[model samples]
Target: MMTAERHFLADDVPDRVRVGVADLAVATGETRVTTSGLGSCVGVAVADPESGVAGLAHVMLPDATGDDRGKPAKSVEAGVERLLAELEAAGGDPERAEAKLAGGSKMFDFSGVSEGVGERNVERTRTALGERDVPIVAEDVGGDYGRSVELIPETWTLTVTSTHKGAEEL
Candidate 1:
């Protein structure tokens, strides 16, 4: 029988909640939310500092063709909308909310695939946020490598980490 290894966080590292691909997470207070290995996928984060409410979404596609069967986090359009709604429900004011976006890396080079999925995801994400009147204050997008993102609701800071480029606060 094989037993799974248990990974424990360091003492200094804050508790982290992971938002997987095609998923979203919202948190308040000191809890931090994270999403990893974003290649063609995009991570959209929104936060309201006053309320200490933050939300993160890992969107895998630009838009949903039909229906996600109630799962909105799978597409950039629905995912961002869902995140914003959750943030507002958590006492975050829409007017005071700000956004940070990362990932959208062009991981492949197909001959005739005009406009890669990464670029499309970024564009659609921007449009969705714009429609909701959420201002995007920072972004780390359009590259050739994957990314990992973490959101700290307490400080309303988003830390983006990339294997090739290290980490930076957005």
Candidate 2:
């Protein structure tokens, strides 16, 4: 539920706006937004390069249909809704939006509560974005490690970084 302190980046430089687990952030101008420590949680990033508007959400669960006990970004459905709204508020056009997703790794394998959580998170993310008519241009999901993501809206780039996979930009 926290957005990083605004940084005045000159032309989408490397200055980052960091978000935490189950948190969401929106940037209007030139800046990179990032989030970390994603294991079995999804990082959803969306952007409109034309407006230099973008948003990021760290989602931990598949759904929050009737649950309101925590931040909206803690769940896939609400997080997508909120993130899109925030981007539009920041002058992003939904019709021109594209998405990049990363992180949904099964970092642990406990029999009690760790089955398919990552898969479900990714599924819900796709479904939510589909409903909003936002196309997923690229993705780096499903694995056995952790990931962190950074989004630079001016170039509409989403960078996925992990200890195991180095770094990739989408």
Candidate 3:
């Protein structure tokens, strides 16, 4: 009998393919994958089917600060913007791409964190996508458990897995 291989390590990012975490990636016929742990942080994936380009955004906040402007785009809004621009540069149509959101768990009580950064991140992402008219095809948000998310560019699929929750197909 043949034994199947048990996977452990992450697959490497393809050449000329960019993987974004609160960042962007663009590729044609190339697979772009990104992963993140969500303990409150929201994991966002944006993909353009035509270009086979995808990006991931691990956003921790709703908006960016003045200092953030100089830093790499990491906020929900800036992250999406950067992803869009990179996709456009890589021959992706902004109008053709769709978004997927995951993560954002109330794993711990913050006492008083003001706005629940996790929820804020989720709401901000929704608002941003709505404004751009980009449809959010799937999501796994707001819970008491942490999650890990992966975006596969080839199939434009976002998979969410968790220790206690097993796995969710999205």
Predicted structure with the largest lDDT when compared to the true one: 2
What are the lDDT figures for the candidates, one per model?
0.82, 0.83, 0.67
Q: How well is each residue in 1-170 modelled by candidate 1, as lDDT tens digits?
A: 10011111223334777887888877776678889989989999998888788888899889786766545578888788788777877668878888999999999888565459999999999999998888899999998999999888888889999988899999
Please give, for residues 86-105, the per-residue lDDT of candidate 2 as tens digits: 87777788889888999888
Query: Stretches of candidate 1 above 4 Å error?
Result: 1-14, 112-115
| Model 2: worst 10 consecutive residues (lDDT sum) | 1-10
For each candidate in turn, give its C-alpha RMSD to the true structure in angstroms: 6.2, 3.0, 8.0
Give lDDT for model 2: 0.83
Q: In model 1, which range of ten residues has the least summed lDDT? A: 1-10
The per-residue C-alpha lDDT of model 1 at residue 95 equals 80
> Which sections of candidate 3 miss by over 4 Å?
1-21, 27-32, 69-71
Candidate 1's clash total is: 0
Higher-ranked by TM-score: 1 or 2: 2
lDDT per residue (tens digit) for residues 1-170 in model 3: 00011101124445333333444444444354555567677877777877676666666677786556332446778777766766666556889889888877777775775447788888988998888888999998988788877667667877788886788777
